[model samples]
Target chain A: MDIAISLPIKDETLLPKLTIGDKIRVNGELFLFRDQVHKKIAENDTDQLDSINFLGSGVYYCAPTPVKEGFLIGSFGPTSSYRMDKYTEYVLKLGFKVMIGKGYRSDDIALLCKKYNAIYVITYGGCGALLNQYVKEVKLLAYQNLGTEAMQRVLVKDFPGYVAIDTFGNKLWK
Target chain B: MRQISCELFSNTLKSLLFETQYFIPEDVLENIKECYINESDSISRDVLNNILQNAKLSAATKLPLCQDTGIPQIFLELGSYVYLNFNLEKTVKNVVNIVYNEEKLRSSCVSDPLIRKNNLHCYSLHVDIVDNESLKVSVLIRGGGSENMSKTEMLLPGTTADEIKNFIVDNVINMLPYTCAPVIVGVGIGGTFEQSSLLAKKALLRNIGQRNQEKFYSMLEDMIKQNVNLKGCGALGLGGRVSVLDVFIETKPTHIATLPVSIVLQCHSVRKASKVI
Candidate 1:
């Protein structure tokens, strides 16, 4: 079944709604971070990273090109999730309800998603041009020197993704 | 002997970078379309369609095909008789800096591995001299994903064909969706450690559908392709029959005691372009 989800991922209410192989389109708030941001956050406290107080939010692993004159964001796509596997457990424990990226997740991440009642999504890799269509607004958040790897808060509408790992421990890929 | 100024050469490099990043080359597009048509799995089919759509949108919008415009690699096959007016390497870097700024591409290169400072003046260059008088310049925009998945192995002189096949298949399984399969696999065999790896990277610069000139290596390329696709890693590694579009092998004579092998992966968004000066 296909489901449309809004930002600020609420309580465990939406946990049972998605299953492995389910199609989903997300709308609302998403935080963009890549390897550097994840590493920095892992070394620091969650409070230092917790400027935005949202219940359950999605975090996208992306490093986007610079936005041209009039565009909201440049071509953006999910990077491989496994590279950030080391810091995922630390970040997920902090109330982030969902993770968005391409490729397979580490076993530990899948297990954590099940335990924390969170989800992992897979967007098509290298489809940055098509993916940018969903992004409505982008605002810089932190780490300006990191360039594309800097954290940004984005507002997206109908961002297409597939549920790779659900809260029930079911996974789309082995 | 023909003479070309550095300014004209840099201008060519600038446009090639812009063209390749935003538009999928004709040969690569045809191969992907063929794979999409032959693929039976719905998931892979949908992903393939999306890939093609992304290419079209990028061209129409005049935006980069992928956000990771990556580190630009410029390969120059210069003629021994040709004359150059300026420093080739410096000219390349200057052109890249200007083009990067004008195009608004991402600066993904890190200056030092440990400190991780972004290097805005990064370019991977290889220059070779051919016997002819004209110069040929080729640019490859390599993304970080497939480049990270690339591997190199040095084996004993007595290693068998079966061993080579198994090693490659194993690596493919390990990379899975991360390498962004339906990739072009380039294999370099028989050179020294560093040369073998360079050969593997250079092999990816070949035109799609181009085959190894030697029959023995060409057959090995065919064998590797069959085995890789048999794994069914498919497009995005979700699942499909066509895991690899092509496999290229470049070989050089090596010492009798060592057999070096290297694999370089190029994802489906293969961006390669060339110009003759």
Candidate 2:
């Protein structure tokens, strides 16, 4: 089943409507963070980090190439979800409601999602070019020195993906 | 001796980088289509369809096919009779920097492994002198997903054929979820530790589904392929009939004491290109 989802979803507002293997077209804000952003956040590098108020927001694990002449974003898509497994629990603990990436996540992520009533969305792994059109707007938020790993606030429209793990701990990948 | 211009090589490298990233090669595209036709699982088929659509879009748009344009490894076959006045590494670094900026590609390479600063030594380069009077360059763009999943093992000289096959099949299956399957497996067998790893990487140069000329190695490659596909890890490891697209194995004479084997994984986006001047 194909479902339409808006980001910054409230507590358990859309949990029952999502299930493993459900295709979703997402629209709304996706807070973008990749390798170093997660590292800095996990390290709690500053007091500023502690006050980030992205509660009930969608978080995407991706870092696209630089924007060329005229584009909202570069070739951007989900990175390998497993590599960010170590930082996932800590970030989720920061009150984010949705996680988006590609491939498998740790079993702990499934358990954590269940415990927190959160959802994990998996998109196409190596399809960044096709996925680039979803970015409606993008703004760099922090850590420009981190290069592509910098944090950004991204607005996406009709972003295509699937619910790989639901709030109930059901997983799409075996 | 024939003299070649430095700008010629630099221009070729720039175009190759763009060409490879934008267009999925004909052979690779054909192989994926074949796999899609044979795929029975609905989810796996959908993934394959997306891959095709992505390739079409990448070429049409001329943006990069994947966000990770990948670490470019340039291999040069310099003709022994050809004369070149430039230093290879410095030239590559200079040209790659300019080309990267022009294309607005990501700066992936770092200066020091520990310090983590961006540096000039971005591409891995290997040059060999050949008899022909032609300079040929081949570039392979390896993304993080498949490259990280690559493995190496030093088996005893006494290890049986079945053991080698099992070693490769098992590891690939286990790493499927992370590698972005279905992947093309490259195996380097029977060289010194370093040479074996090189051979494995070079094996990716083979056209997809092209078997080794020797019957024994060719059969071994087929065996590994069959075993992996039978496991049904499928596209993106989402459970399907095709986990591996193909397997290519390269071999060299090795020391009697040690048998080195290295497996390099190439994801669905098998980006490689070559040009001669």
Candidate 3:
């Protein structure tokens, strides 16, 4: 059976429907961050991230171009996720259920996703401009020193992606 | 001798850098169009559509084609007859700064690769001098996806062609969907260790679908493509015939006792542009 869903998903909603090989298209704001922003978040204890409700939320491993005069952001796309694997368990604990990025993940992270009933999606690696159009709105959140790797809240519409690893421990590609 | 102002050189560099961020080079665009029209799988087709649309939108809206706008790499062939009134290195730096600062392209360069600290706002530039009166520059916006997949090896003189092919094929299969497909493979052979790797990168700068001039190198290109495609890492590695868009090889003379090779993968978004002044 085929199922379609929207973004800002709840853990229960994702845990049941998505399986290996199932495609997912999310319509919600995607946050962009790379190594620097992730490192900062990993080192911090204040829980500043609590303000953002991640329950069933998706985070794209990306460092976007700075916003120009009229646009919300520039050339937004996914970066490799392996670099951020260390923080996955913690973020999942915070209620962020889905992660979007390119490349493979550690086995521990995959197991964690299965335990937490979360999913990891992979988008095309170099399709930044193509992916940016889906971003409806973008707000700069934090990590100013990081330049392109700064954290920003982004709203996306019909953001197309494929499930690389799903909640049930099925991997789409070996 | 003709005199060119520093400002002119700087501005020209700026334009090339900024324009290259969004615009797909003519050859790359054409090759992708061919792929889009010929691809059989619906999913792959849709992906191609997204890529094509992204290119159009990026060009029209002046947004970078990808977030990893890549380290700013410049290849220049400066003419001997032209006199530069300003420092070439400073001019290049100034242009890179303007593009990254004002244009808002991602700063891919970091202070330390191991430490992973972003070096404020900086980009990478490679300069070369050639015999010419007019400056010819090629600006390549290389994504990290492909850059990370690059590999280098030093083999004993007895390394067989079959072994070389297997090594490359093994790397490609292992990468699977990670490096993104269909990838453009660039192989550099016969140079010293570092030289081979640089030649591999330089090979990637060639226009997509352009064949190598040497007959043997051309055959090697064909051999690599067939071997890689047989692995079934298809388009996006989802399983299809178009695993690789093309394979390019560049070679140089090497030591009698050593054979070196470097494999550099270029993702589907093969971005590069050139300007002559």
Candidate 3 per-residue C-alpha lDDT over B125-182 given as tens digits, one digit per residue, 9 for 90 to 100: 6656667678877776677777788888898889987888778777767765676677
In model 1, the clashing pairs are A9-A56
Q: Which is superior by lDDT, 1 or 3?
A: 1
Predictions in order: lDDT: 0.85, 0.85, 0.76
Docking class of 2: medium
Q: What tens digits encode model 1's per-residue C-alpha lDDT throughout B190-224? A: 88998898898889888788999988778888888
Calculate DockQ per candidate and list them: 0.77, 0.71, 0.64
**Which candidate gets the maximum DockQ versus the true structure?**
1
Q: Best-fitting candidate, measured by lDDT?
A: 1
Best-to-worst order by lDDT is 1, 2, 3
For A1-174, candidate 3 gives per-residue lDDT tens digits of 234456677448555577766666777766766666666666774255657766677778888776766777777778878878887776777677778887677777778888988888877667777777778887777766666777778888777787778887777663
Candidate 2 off by > 4 Å? A11-13, A49-52, B118-121
What's the TM for model 2?
Answer: 0.96
TM-score of each: 0.97, 0.96, 0.91
